[model samples]
Target: MSPDRSQTAYAASAADLAVRALDALRGIGGTAMVAEHVERAEDPKAALAAIRVVGADTFAPYLLADAVFHPQDAAAVTQSFALFPPPVSTPDPPPAGAAEPWLVAWRDWAMAALLARLAEAEPDGVRAPRPTGAPVLTDPDHSQVSDAPAGQGSDSHAAHGDGLPTPDSGAPDDSGPRDTDWQRWSVRMGQLSPLALPGLDGPVHSAARAAPLALARGATRAVLRRDFPTAARITRWLALLGAEGVALPLDPVPLLAHLRLHGGGPRLALDVAIARRLLGLETV
Candidate 1:
């Protein structure tokens, strides 16, 4: 099969898998097992390709809920990386206003590493630093979100109430140009949405903490443009902020419902389902 075909098969499988995971997340039906959806094939190459596509999110269910992390699942996620290999190491790009792709890949790996650690399977050979599962912005009991106050500032910096950069704003020195263009900024947040889960934090989460309204605005814009995938990704950030008690520019509840209704495919559905979990909207 062509790469596209593999992706098509994987996306359908992933989405269905996400639906099962979502059910598990809501305490309904059976637990979502990674091996079932991720390994529904005899073709090792295809399975590996699918794992690479979803990256760390392949273990999202385990992270989101108390789902068991069987050894096979851990080995499958680990083996896929060995088969496909990680990206070539790249130097830290100069502190810039926008996120570079390398940074996003590293963040993705951080999520995977966190899950690997939870599974107690120190995946050998992978190079991303270990992720501390410390709570960044999650309160397991958190379940409410509010709208931005009337006349609140909407610029990128002020989008975060109080207009202060969080502690882990960026590189150690915290020096370098910061991107203020909401368009680019929102897109980068969307790409790094995989980091929007509970129990993880860093530059990306810090960056997100600095821009709730911008993230909400970007998500609304994507919805208007019929770019559901982009909208859904940004929604993940919005959902996270809402959970963190940040006053958002929009309500995440209806937005999640909209995506569930119109966001094409299981992959995008997976994003929305994850967003729903972030928002604590535990229902069908």
Candidate 2:
């Protein structure tokens, strides 16, 4: 297939898998009694590619709503990590909010860590394989960083004093938006929205903690510009903050409703659904 055709095909497959994952997220949130499984166990390569697109979100139902973790899904995720790995080398002492390369590796590490914890249940005698770049699990339910040092464990990005980077840490100014610039800041935040999930922590979360109002303002700006995707992603950050009990300047409930009305894709739907759960408004 030509590059264009290949890209198109991959996009279609990823979209379908994302919707299936969305269904599982909604179902586990009580929209349905049981969520649908998302792995294409028949075709490991296709499944792995789809999983790469979905990223850590493949486990949203299991992570967010306590849904059962099937071994097949875990195995697929493991395979993706090993086959389609994150960058092998990170910037030494990676800049906080480092660009795509580090973020990819960092997210993979967190996803792997979460996968390991979910495996502890071992339902039906199926234990998930540990991915190569995962962080060490220490109190999976809480504490974003493990006991390992900041630079330890696959550049999972605990580069500050503790596992969590301080809000005051140096910014990735050249690569990302500076906090003073809400417009560009929002775009960068949107890109890092995937990191906004519960049980995942790092520099981005610390930044959000310090600037809930900034995120809110950024979300509002995105909405004003009719950039629903960016708006929705920023809303996800706000929702995470709300979940963490950080006082948000703007109420996320109404913003979520707005995004639900305007957003037009399964990935956006998935973000909204997870945001609802975070805000204790899980009605699917």
Candidate 3:
């Protein structure tokens, strides 16, 4: 397969594997059943299917697949698909507080376990720190950046301990186009035609299409290479819109609701917030 086609195919395959694995776990029924499944499987697929039959079919397998193919959200490592909260027994309260304790605990445990496994699997420490989304990126808005003259924030960024530029800093470029990766990336960004994602129109669609090129450039230039915050943001959005083959939402509420339905975390939450803020949806 051509590179892009191959990527698309691989994504479809991974998703298929994830769904099948979850199905298997559902078949198993409960914690004990999942453990038994794990004991029997040699490969991840078998392991996932085994886990699927269990009642708490962890989203770990699908989340892992997402990370392998997309690798944008560090949170994905711990994201679980296994346990769906049982229906609320009592009538609805006037106001809800937080997610149920068991659900939250399950998510945390899954995330933490995945993080530990990732650390064990990759000893080189070459990857960027997976984001916990505690402290936000705190960069000025992308629109603000784009609105500024080409050279704005091109320099004067705070240096990291290792001296790599921070997220807000445009990719390291010299005094001219040769000085930075962004310039080259910008050119590629300009060259890319907007993809016809579902429901996308006007500015939002335009921004979504252009955003990936900027992210792609960042990935290629070793700017937060393994850190997939931006890419994940884009992918999750694409998945939702593409799934229905509908236009992307003009408003953020639909998007936020969609994320909640799909399962959400710090990264997806942050993306929803950012996208809302950027599009002026928060003001509405």
Q: List the residue pairs that clash in candidate 1.
A: 15-266, 97-179
State the displacement of the C-alpha of residue 89, model 2, in Å, after optimal TM-score superposition.
1.5
TM-score leaderboard ranking: 2, 1, 3
lDDT per residue for candidate 2 within 1-284, as digits (tens), equals: 67776666667766776777777776623332112223333444555666777766766787677567766566656666666766545432233333445445555556665667666632332222322222121222333322211222111122222222333332544434333234444455565566677777765566677667667887887788687877787898899988888988999899889889976798888888888888888586
Q: What is each predicted model's overall lDDT from 0 to 1?
A: 0.59, 0.59, 0.31
lDDT accuracy of residue 129 in candidate 1: 53
Instruction: Give the alpha carbon lDDT tens digit for every residue of 1-284 in model 1.
Output: 88888778766554555565555555555432556655566555665566666655656667666577677766676776677665565423313212233444555466466655766666776555532221122111332222111111222332333212323342232223342234444654576666777767666666577668667877887788677877888888888888898888789889889888884876677788788777776563
Better of 1 and 3 by TM-score: 1
The 10 consecutive residues of candidate 2 with the worst lDDT sum are 147-156
The TM-score obtained by model 3 is 0.23
lDDT by residue (123-232, candidate 3, tens digit) is 22222221111111112233322210011111222111112222445454433432343333222222111121222233323343434434334323322333233333
Cα lDDT for residue 34, model 3?
32
